[model samples]
Target: MSDLHCPARILLVDQRPAGALAERLSRESLAATYDAPVDLDEVADRHRGETVLVVGPLPAEHAHAGGPVVLVEVDADGRRTSPWDVPR
Candidate 1:
């Protein structure tokens, strides 16, 4: 399917804690955000419906988790890039 209609929930994985990012994502009009530690397998199983996974400074282990995975590096500039960045 086209990227515009990707059917997957958005999962945000981070090692530095997901409080700040989750808050920001929740405030935005984007997809809902699920906060979890950097556990690929667990996160994958629990949120299997996830089509787009956003990782913050965490390794990209869920790349092969049966869907498109977006790796986002939380840089010092506070910039985060992910599949979600694509305009709706």
Candidate 2:
């Protein structure tokens, strides 16, 4: 079960949230949460872990100085962007 009051262990930022995926992730006992780009900052602040994996379209702004954030871009076809191509 995910603790809403505490920071999330995994933050899944998907423009189109997939119910099945979110549910599956939660079953693993990790505090997984669904969110959009606009709420990245607010959500990031609530992150119990340091890394964040975005599984859909890239957010307009997701960079923060609070901690290390890892954003992964996934296309409509479910193709993930290469790590080498990700911005520093």
Candidate 3:
């Protein structure tokens, strides 16, 4: 909607099911999906040039994969947690 070209696909990796975020992303016209596997290497390989990875509260290791990675945190009330709030 913002004239931003959506990636071919978006991979959402979260510790818990991210139904809400996935729904929100879908509404934004971005092709999004979810995978809850313990290992991400395989998924990353399959989506090589077509996916933008979105990670939730997981280890940093799983946050960076391919394309542009977005780290999101949602509170119990479904409010998004700001990365700036994370103390250095």
Clashing pairs in 2: none
How would you encode candidate 2's per-residue C-alpha lDDT over 7-60 as one tens digit per residue? Answer: 433334434434654454444553343544435545445553433444554453
Q: Write the per-residue lDDT of candidate 1 for residues 1-88, one digit (tens) a residue.
A: 2232223344455433245554545554533344444554443334433333444544545443322235333322332435433222
lDDT of each: 0.41, 0.39, 0.38
Q: What is the lDDT of candidate 3?
A: 0.38
Q: Which of candidates 1 and 3 reaches a greater lDDT?
A: 1
Ranking by lDDT: 1, 2, 3
Query: TM-score of model 2 relative to the true fold?
Result: 0.30
Q: Candidate 3's residue-wise lDDT over 1-88, tens digit each? A: 2212322333444543345554544445433345443344444334433444445544454355422234332222322222221111
User: By the TM-score metric, which is better: model 2 or model 3?
Assistant: 3
Model 3 alpha-carbon miss at residue 29, Å: 7.2
* Leading candidate by lDDT: 1
lDDT for 18 in candidate 2 is: 47
